[model samples]
Target: MVLLPFSARNTSETNDWNGSKLKDDSKHYKLLVVGGGAGGLGAASKFARKLPRGSVGIIEPHEDHYYQPGFTLVGGGLMTLRETTRKQEKLIPSGAKWIRNEVVLFTPTQNMVTLDGGEDISYDYMVVAMGAHLRFDKIKGALEALETPGVCSNYSPFHVEKHYREVMNFQGGNAIYTYPNGPIKCAGAPQKACYITDSILRQRGVRENAHMIYATSLDKIFGVENYVKPLEEVAQEKDIDVRTRRNLIEIDTSKNSATFQLLDENGAATEDTEKIEYSLLHIGPPCSAPKALRKSPFADKTGFMDVDDGTLQSKKFPNVFGVGDCMNTPNAKTAASVSSHLKTLDRNLTFAMLGKKPYFKYDGYASCPLVVSKNRVILAEFNSKGPLETTPLNQGKPAYWAFLLKKYFMPALYWNGLIRGYWNGPATIRKFSRLVDSKKRQGVL
Candidate 1:
């Protein structure tokens, strides 16, 4: 196998290969994907099957691939951490070359990327799907508090299982659930774990002793208003206190207390400071694109890849595109969104390679399975404008069918249809359902 070397020094000035002062041959690829996560793998798999074997390469450091959506379930005691991860080698398509190294720098202007191991790779087209970085340490006292009892987070696979343990061991007092201030991958997950804990406590006959509180920076239960009313009702019925515009600032683990700062309507910090004691605390840490991307010139002001909202193409560099949580697209970051991104990126990138106008556009489609209880789920599907329900039945109302779809059907669809690039969300199915509904209404009239 031919090995490439990388250098932090300016590569344009130096010319050496294998200890020889020779000009490095810039290797070109049809497609280069940066991450090994869901979006990257989905895009790579699709492109690999379409492009020739040697035409595609994936730069990923980790050897293990995680089904991150399952982390919420793991925290809820419905799944295990071991079940959420798979060998990265098994997930990458057979034809695509996997470069087991992290990208240190992305030079979008030159169509090149530098790896941490001092290797340089050039591509004709690139997809940035590095995803979001969970910054647990960003919150004051979070890291230290996590080391102590009565504190946990489900955002990472490493810490998800600890959530259940913490919940089960709680004797009595406030059980706090926190949602961070920024965009979080699987937006529904943090609250889902809270609901599960509530259910578990109810089943154990300890619900009366434990006070459940959801402190979120956002004012609404959900971004899409269709599910908001129902979710609010669920919280009310479960006696879960919902506090909006409350941001977690510090944790006094010794005293088992948490500090929160209230924000005004404009999101400015206010004078109000609230402190509460807790027996169990579930934190959803602030998330952003990886630090490497933040430091790169390719990133926007928000430290995310600046991509066109509709086309998924980089604004500064036409040859570069972004998918998943790494891009500054105003869509909920989820595995379901990545499935939509894969289709959009695949078609647009191919069009760019052929020097033709891109034909496809991504409407910011994303799905969030709001697991309200052990046996029910509110399958929230929406696009940029608003809710786009796929099923003909009332999606706002939680149903057993939605629960089954989320637990059993969605995972299978993700593994088979999404990972393979066959799934482009449920747009066509949704359209068909709408057509059928129209026909049924006409007949009734």
Candidate 2:
């Protein structure tokens, strides 16, 4: 493939594209990646190294990239917002061409995408990794409430920093945290914020005065049953009132109250409504795939990229695949899931390019290091079947080492390993740990 030099024309259509010249109205690549988040960057990095230079292209709109898992730490006062961010340009692979724009239209049937700057991008194969969007506006007063003093959300970078402040400033009253009624990245994050706040309040001698409540749409404390028992125990020990089937529908900033709609076991909303006055409110906002994918032909009814659950390939378009939270998969939307799913995506996409049927299947693998306190975390690892723990220790119990890993090691792994295509989840590590365990049992030196 021949790489064209960027033109110097200052056309209106290419003005927002960072002044990068378009050789023509359309450009083609061997492989194209949408979004520069964990999944996109990882897959692009893998193919960029495999394909010829300039054959791989990535379309991303943002200037900054974030280590999103660190947001929980930031809200817990364990990490700063700046520590979780980096320049998006620096993270792109050397062999990949970066298209600094967002996709306005996705035409998978034509193997083409139209950018916001009106440039057409076509590729032999495409990977959609646009990730999910936090729809805070879904709740009636969420946006306005986020600007207020006591209302904050770890899901939003703008308001994440305020969570620590809100926890510290709380004198006494109801400290309410909410979980929305849809798929969200890091399903464990909502309670992480609450647990951190409980730790901080107890340290400040305010735990006795505050009534801590966790309101979630789910019927259980956690999806994975192996981890739920311990988490419920932790909640009970921390004196947190865990209310299931309660979803935050609105926030009243003027009255310092939050309204929750009660749901039945089937997740259907009932007419009963409960309003609780709060000293501080932390919301895990509802999330959805990007509007471009939602409106596209390859979208599922839930507005996510329509792909086969096990193959991660578009059902209708064989050349199109999905990675990360944007895809309609049964797994929890976490960066760890991206790391594992990308392994399946990378192999399957490569096979598709070579006109071979993909043999590898994604097991819906996902991990969540549930931070239950300041220095304790329950590392929950599982797949569609059940608990797929990496270590020999019981992962359902809170451990200090897991806390340290979540707080420190995971961030470094994300920046240096995952997005660079060097990490392929914990399968290798899990295998190694099992080998060691067997050796130990046999008394092997």
Candidate 3:
């Protein structure tokens, strides 16, 4: 593999090996991956190791890679912001060609993608992994409100550290946290910050004075009912007020007031508006797929890459596939979900390349380690059907052991196993544990 010298030409211009202009026609690759996030990197790593050298080309704009799940811990002070990031060059597989560019257009019809620089890259097969976009500016008063002392959010790398500072500075008052009205990565994260803040306040002997409140646009605490009951119990035990059907509308930083529109059970906005004074605010903003992909012909009506739920291939374009947060798969967006996606995508894409049908189907497995407190967690593992537990022990119950797995083992598995294309989540482990549990019951009889 050779490292091409950095050409200073504009993105639209064609270049030769000697830095001069090339002929109209250009080179292509077997696989082209857009985005360098978890899904893109995961797919690139698998293809680079399995396919011949120079077979894969990755178009990613960022020079750094982030382990985004750790951002919650960073906000909780369990990990530093520095720990969540690494150089993108280190993560991109050695054999793959890296184009430090963003995809400006997706031309599925032509089997090509145009980069921001105006250069066109053609591929025999393409994988779209450009993850979701966080739009904080869409919310009214969000930008102005966030500049105030009490306002903070953990959604972006730029704003994550402010969460801890805001929580710590809170003397005593309504400490509100929120979940936006759309699909968000790590659904448990908004509440995780609240839980961590509650624990922190208790440690500082201020828990009694602080009124912890959670305002979410969703009607339920969690999507899965199995975890919802136990999580509600945890909130009750912590004296946190959980309000559903409340959407954050505006913020008045000068007056230190947060405004919310109350919605009925049917999701219609009611006439009444609620205002609360807050000492601290943690926000989870709305997210969507990158604009380029969302507007492209490849996207579904919901603005995500329309892929087969089972095989991870585009429903309209067989040669195009997606993995990670960008795909319209019915799984919670988490690193755990990405682990499962990569496994199914690897096998199915390989089969597709061989002109054969995909044998394996993804079950929508996604896991969220609900950090209920500083030392305990409830490992919520589920698939499209419902919760899929791996441990023989009951998972709905909070356990210290589960916390340890989340804090230590899970990070290692993500960096080494998932990123290396070796991990496929805990599905096999879940199956094996079920078998062991069955045998144990028989023996007890």
Candidate 4:
């Protein structure tokens, strides 16, 4: 198979794509990847080697891929934007075909996907890892607030840089941070941004003027208790006022106020909506899978890819698999979760191709490095069976080591090891750690 240059590929239809320079209007491959994020690119890059050259086709529009987890540190002024990205052409496996375009339609019945340019790419097997995206426009007045000076979010690349600048300029008074109403990519990130801002304010000797407030749509501070117990202590110790079950409804950037809806036990907003004044506002926008997949037979009622929680295979289509943030599984949608799921997904998908029963199991392992301060993090690691701590020590306590791991090593692993499919997750360490077994029985390692 002859390979074309990256510049020759149709990255987008509006941008100089014409059949005049093409050999064929359509193509077929053994494996097709729908997204270029951590999930699709990682799986495609790793599995491409197992197949012949040009057997894998990946649909991605962006030229630069981001290390999303590092955005938290970027917001905290601990890292730069350059540290969180890589050229897309460089990361694509040498053998795989890069279909540099966004998928406009999913036709599972026919085993094909249509690109925005009206060309259909057929595949024997496909990975539907179309990652989630921020819906800032869904929330009333959110887009304007994102463009404003004091309001910022770490959720988007365009706005994350604004966060560090906002924190530096904040003279202080009623600084508010919000966690969105539904399942977010990183549940801990919104609060992490708050803590980092608070730390910066303290370090700059302006803590006396700042009233740090954290409001979230989730009922609890965090999902798991092993870490929640200590996080509550940190909140109280730092005087960061915490309010739960409150979701952002609207923002009044002109007056520096935000409106929130109080969710009842049923998760429906009651008649009352409260508005509060603010100086600095950080927003975690509502997220969902891409629209095309949601309309296809692959997604659930909530616009998430419906897949077997254990196998990571689609319940409806045997040839289809879900990965990354697009999956309907209850696991936290972090890169760490994607790493764990891909390990199982790779094996299960391979088994399906071989017409064998899937033997490997994905136990819903996911980790969120909660950056409580600039140099400390509570590494929240867990599965369906409650807390599955990686080390022997109480992981709830914010440790400088975890922070260092998040700051320095994670990006290297993501770029070098993870996309290569060599690094699945920390599950092996969690299972084999001598400290974990001894500490559980003796209360100390």
Candidate 5:
């Protein structure tokens, strides 16, 4: 059961939030949530129940909400695009008002935000969960390449379905997958696609003719050292050419070719460039914080929302906070991390509402289900300090049960548990499992 703050019941609202239609352009709310993605929905649902009706307002322009983690499954032929999507209206919390518009400008100092439709809304407290924006056009000719026959991407909804189809129809040649130069939401997704493709090709007896390559701008395959060895082993076993320090810069759809800028160990581009022709290509497009947030007063030097990593509160604005990919936290930008953020942000923001400083702190917990094949996965969980496994089993090693957890269980948990704000990640389960393991070791069970 969710704990509600008894002191924050009498919240100010523009109109009766329970009404079906929005009244005016100018509005006010006790709490304003920006972006309707995982983080936004989680925060809104949690606080909507805590505050009075018409007190919480969620500003989101899109008509659909996507289960972003399901994209890899869709690309791997395990799920459909429709299964990953839901109408945005159906997900909004019952008591909260939904403002169907984009935020064009943020005036956090004045506790107000300007919408693209020329309306201004004010709030006493705000949560920035705008998330990340995919920039496929950053690569020259990328847009055109996406339209080409053999090139595809799992990042975009428009091209995600094409990925499995391309893999299915693959006759053989160079099948190249790329990871961009900077931080992406799911850092492991690019290689997930590569591994899935390798599995498919081998199953279809086309592995002999296919030259699989995993090109990445990072110096290593994965950031966490604990999971790197297993991933490297997987690549080696599949005979994949793992190329590091190579950032894709251009794509020529007509020529069926791609150009990459070679980088030094420091990740700075060198003078050298390489071009490779491909029979199939999967691009992991570069991503960053949304435009408004990037240019807002809350952003850090890296164009991501600047927040206190521990408290999830804005360093510049005390009344503001951030969650998800938009925040400049060291943790991997996955939905799992967002779920972890919800609890921390909730405790801290609720304290703020009561005119008190934040007491709860977030330990940078994150998890990435590295899908190595249709039947195997390496569940990589970690924090700022190092590897922090949840289960009693060794998560560093790929396991079939982990794959089943990722493929079958996670989506249901996300839709029914996390989105509705009940899920707070696997911390509770981890604690319980650890207790059981300790009892077993002492012969207590």
Candidate 6:
């Protein structure tokens, strides 16, 4: 659920929350889920129905659930933020108990989690899906500058709408977009912001007056070559300057200047630096696992939960598992990847609960829909082995149909199927589409 506030009446007062307030300020459950975003909701839904009522417990302090992928469209002015959100009470599965608080500590050794307000919870099996936190504080002046007139970001709900406003307010100058270093969700978002900005400027016929530039820490425009070639062509056609190995080190809001620390292909900073003054700046901030997860016994040194890349089960404790952005998997972090993660966890975690070794493996699948134009998208889908083509048509090119699927179809599926633990991503769709294509090619209709 999107973390936000609601009236007291709308919470425990309106309905009977199944979570108990024990005499020892403690609770227990057969299964516990920390964080109520996509992964937590999916996990709770998967197992709760099979077990008795109140068997699953989810700890999340939120009132509204957000369809996060829609944030990009919201920021681009194609959709409204309200359209991406739903009441958390309505979204949490019927059988699962929702604890409206955050976990302060995770104790995998004792199979317990300590929550704020001094409540302790013990579970037979636990799934950590707390995901990561954005740190605008990472780059000096970045967080503080978010309130400044010309600076904005799509990463936070509080600021996503500001991007459209900033772009619309532009009077013709440098419009700069940045991709941060370190791990972050939605790797393609920075460039999406760039493209959205470009779309808005071109729509306003102010493209000639503005310099659309993208500054990224990555060596390439995109990870998969199948989509990168098309993205490069889009960049060339749009006249968007795509600068690689340039990290946004500092944002000087007062002077409307951004500082970039140049890096070599080897990923080290050099003595050379470049500065650009901008009218509107959109930044993708650096991110890491939540503070509690980072400080917990389960987390790796880099602050991600240590889990087997194949099974997604905790390396230290077999009864524990991880999904989504919280795990130290090498896969690209995105909600599209969450479908694959949750699909694997729903199967493997249940087997683990039965005292069986998980035989399932998660392919590092991910998708990124690059909004190259108003009604066009370059859909990229791939796994560890490289591009895993899902659709029958060549998906490397930008198409309005892809954009329509992203803009309309995805949100509906996410709300109706994904949160209900029924959707397992487009892999099946890919296979079925391939089968249909095969029949057509063989004239077996």
Global lDDT of each candidate: 0.82, 0.89, 0.83, 0.84, 0.90, 0.84
User: How well is each residue in 1-445 modelled by candidate 4, as lDDT tens digits?
Assistant: 1233343232322121112232332476667899988889888876776666776889999999999999999999999998898999998888888889998898887777889989888776789888998888878999998888789999888889999999999997888999988878888999999999889999999998999989988787887877777899889888998988899999998888999999997777887788989989999888988888888899899999998898988899887888889989988889998888888977887776665777788888888999999999998888767886788777888999989999989999998888766778887887678556876789775
lDDT per residue, candidate 1, 287-370, as tens digits?
989988999887889998888898999888887889899999988988988888887887787777666677688978898989
In angstroms, the error of model 2 at 427 is: 0.8
lDDT of 2 by residue, 1-445 (tens): 1122233211223321223434443376767899999999999998877776777889999999999999999999999999999999999999889999999998876777999978888776789999999999899999999999899999888889999999989999999988899988899999999999999999999999999999999999988888888999999999999999999999999899999999998999999999999998999999999999999988999999999998999998888899999999998999999988888987898787666798798988899999999999999999767898899998888999999999889999999999998888999989999999999999994
- lDDT of candidate 3 over 1-445, digit per residue (tens): 1221223111334432234543443346667899888888888888887666676888898987888888888888888888888898998897888889898898887777888878888776788989888867766888877777888888778788988887777789999998887778888999989999999999889899999999988898888889999999999999999999888877778778888888889877898889988889887887888999999987888898898888998988887789999989999988899988988888887777666787689889999999998888999998877988889998899899998898888888878888777787788888888888899999952
- Model 2 sits at a Cα RMSD from the real structure of 5.4
Pairs with steric clashes in candidate 5: none
For model 3 the local lDDT of residue 176 reads 96
Backbone atom clashes (below 3 Å) for every candidate = 4, 0, 1, 0, 0, 1
Candidate 5, residue 177: the lDDT equals 96
Best by TM-score: 5
Question: What TM-score, computed on C-alpha atoms, does each candidate reach?
Answer: 0.92, 0.93, 0.92, 0.92, 0.95, 0.93
Best by lDDT: 5
User: How many backbone clashes are present in model 5?
Assistant: 0
> Which of candidates 1 and 2 is the stronger one according to TM-score?
2
What TM-score does prediction 2 earn? 0.93
* Model 6 stretches with alpha carbons more than 4 Å out: 1-26, 442-445
Q: List where candidate 5 sits over 4 angstroms from the true fold.
A: 1-7, 10-26
Give per-residue lDDT, candidate 6, residue 18. Answer: 34
Which regions in candidate 1 have their CA more than 4 angstroms from the true location?
1-28
